[model samples]
Target: MLEEAEFDRDDAAPIDMLESYFAAHGWSHERDDDEIVAKVKGSWAEYELRAIWREDDNVLQFLAFPDVRVADERRATIYETMGLVNEQLWIGHFELWSTSGILLYRHAAMIDGEGGGTLTLDQAEMLIESAIDECERFYPVFQFVLWGGKTPKEAIAASLIETQGEA
Candidate 1:
């Protein structure tokens, strides 16, 4: 829940900043963050999934997932899967900004907002991998939307960009 940021004009690209920051904290992206952000913004292909994790005061603890796609029945399927009808959970996208792991986006949702929960490394990895696997399972529908026919790994990298404006 980070408020307005007073960003420095000389701030490095988010990916670089995040990597250095995470490395300092003993964390690292599975792949390069710069390339991922570029691909997502450029939209070379449809990223199939996206996710983010935040801690107290809106600082992001973790962020990952495949990019999003907007094709055919797949779009509907994704929304349906994520709807969580009776559950209170919602999907959130995180944009990188600081070396301290703070998020820049404001529109992030609270999945199961009524009952907040903790996220562990295992949970984060599971959620991200599951989303990628689900998208792969529904390849026919997802392929036509955003992935631009690239492999799942590429899509995952693209997802790291963390678009703030797009829903």
Candidate 2:
């Protein structure tokens, strides 16, 4: 028989920290067990973001699903595009949920002090912000491949902006 993990009441749990973090940012969110669900509006589209706390691993994983869904026929191309996009990202990577054909941007942060250390609000905010920024940055490229019928290489090439100089 496995025993349930015990957490200190005096200190806020990881989920609680995440909830408070989102609220501070003025974002509406829901907390269910170990998962925090929130909607973030980006330049490209609104995303459904979920943050899951894994006690055993001491890792908080964030996943954001874009409003667009890839058709079965386009999965291969989209997946290829994702491969190229993932390389340019500093924090998270985009992936396709094969079973549902949904594209998701994912990133995880290791919550330090797992034994007794608390996860600071600053750390939580950083994790969420990084994921959102990465998703918004590459969202258009994904759309170009899925709906615009652009090849993976072409879509990626077009998304790269060549800054000329200060005008």
Clashes of each: 13, 0
Q: Assess candidate 1 and give its lDDT.
A: 0.33
**Candidate 2: Cα lDDT at 140:** 75
For each candidate in turn, give its C-alpha RMSD to the true structure in angstroms.
Answer: 15.4, 7.1
TM-score of each: 0.27, 0.84
lDDT (Cα, tens digit) per residue for candidate 1, span 75-99 = 4433433332112223433233333
With a 3 Å backbone cut-off (N, CA, C), the pairs that clash in candidate 2 are none
For model 2, the local distance difference test gives 0.77
lDDT of each: 0.33, 0.77
lDDT score, candidate 2, position 48: 88
Q: Write down the worst ten-residue block by lDDT for model 2.
A: 1-10
